[model samples]
Target: MKLRSLLFVPGDRPERFPKAVATGADALILDLEDSVVPERKPEARAAVRAWIEAPREDGPAVFVRVNPIDSDEVAADLEALAGLSLDGVVLPKAEGAESVAMLLDRLPGDYLVLPVASETPAAVFQLGTFAGVAGRLAGVTWGAEDLPASIGAATAREDDGSYTDPYRVVRALTLFGAHAAGVPAIETVFPDFRNLDALAAYAARGQRDGFTGMLAIHPTQVSVINDAFTPSEAEIAHAKAVIAAFDANPGAGALQLDGKMIDAPHLKSARRLLALVG
Candidate 1:
């Protein structure tokens, strides 16, 4: 699926499910963890299952963020979802490849896995190994709040409430690792819903750094994130032109295009863009 922006909806709030499905997000993540309180877990799970079981329209892809595999609720969550139609399971507090392996042992192989890179201190170091998680592992993402609390350090944020350098470094490293492993690097969410400018800048940065998509905490942020990641008309046109020029001169290693030297590498980049367009 071409998921440029995946929005999260609290599982307990079933009233928001239909609205979320209509938000134009590439995917809708029905969150059962962090968003739903302990007392409401059972109710949330029931609501999510009911929503998934019912027939629906051509809505966004649906993923369920179940509780951590290590938690007591893991088995129940798995049993509940195993009988339903879900695009994937967003595993929270994933420590290493073993955590994914354990889940694979329990869940069916057909289900995709999107692990939240690390929410605990031990997980920060193991982020590199996320690619090793086999069995339809879709992508890797991270959370700042849990990690900081695990280490007794404050989560990094600027005066404007944007993620600080430390968190940005983690996000970049996760993206690099995902690329190294040849998976889409799904970016973490920007919590500041009110700061549209900051959110746009963050999404743009993710696109520039090779991230395929980002998770959204609010529907309002979906359009900006999707726009930042998609190739622009000018970019698409330039890519087509480069390919056309190369096709017309197949033997040439380099050629002039708009006053600039277009070499093999430039042509290769252009071809990738054209591929995206097609």
Candidate 2:
């Protein structure tokens, strides 16, 4: 799937589901975790189940963000999703391969899993181990929200809303870890949805830094995320030119393209860019 954007809709708000789907996000996550209060978890689960089971021919693929594996409500979350057609599950606060494997074991059928690889202090260290479970994973992502509270820190981000040094390290680890696992590195959400310019910059930076997609907290951010990740027509044309240079050169190790020397690595990058459109 082309997952340039994955928008989150609170599972309790079924009314918002169609609206979220209409946002043109590549996928929609019916969130049953942090978005739902503890008292309404059961109700949220039922709502998500009904939405997933309903008939819908067109829209983005649907995924659900279940509570943490250790939470008392997780089992019920999984049970409620049984026999439903879901594209995946966004496993928040995921630690390592073991936790992911446990969740996979409980799920009834083949389901893509996108683990939020960094949340707790320990999870920061376990990012590298995700390669072991890459086959079942759709991708890997990270978030800065819960970590500060977990460690009793004042905040995870600076006054500018950018991540602090530690959180930056966490983001880097998640990015590199997903690449090491051979999965797309999905960047975390930008909490300040009101700042569209900043959000666009952040999404552009993610694409430049090798993130294949980004999580969205609000539906309004979806278009910006999608546009940032998607290759423009000019980019596609340039990529085709690069590939054509290599093709024409036959066995040549390097070639000149518009006065610049192009090599094997450049060809690889061009091919990857073109693949995004496909």
TM-score of each: 0.92, 0.98
Q: lDDT of each model, Cα atoms only?
A: 0.84, 0.92
For residues 20-92, write the lDDT of model 1, one tens digit per residue: 8777898889988999988998999899999999998878889999899889888878887886887888899
Candidate 2 overall lDDT versus native? 0.92
Measured with C-alpha atoms, the lDDT of residue 210 in candidate 1 is 78
Error of 1 at 51 (Å): 0.6
lDDT of 1 at 122: 73
Model 1 scores a TM of 0.92
- Which candidate wins on TM-score? 2
For residues 192-272, write the lDDT of model 2, one tens digit per residue. Answer: 999999999999999999999999999889999999999999989989999999898899999998999999998999999
Clashes of each: 0, 0
Clashes of 2: 0
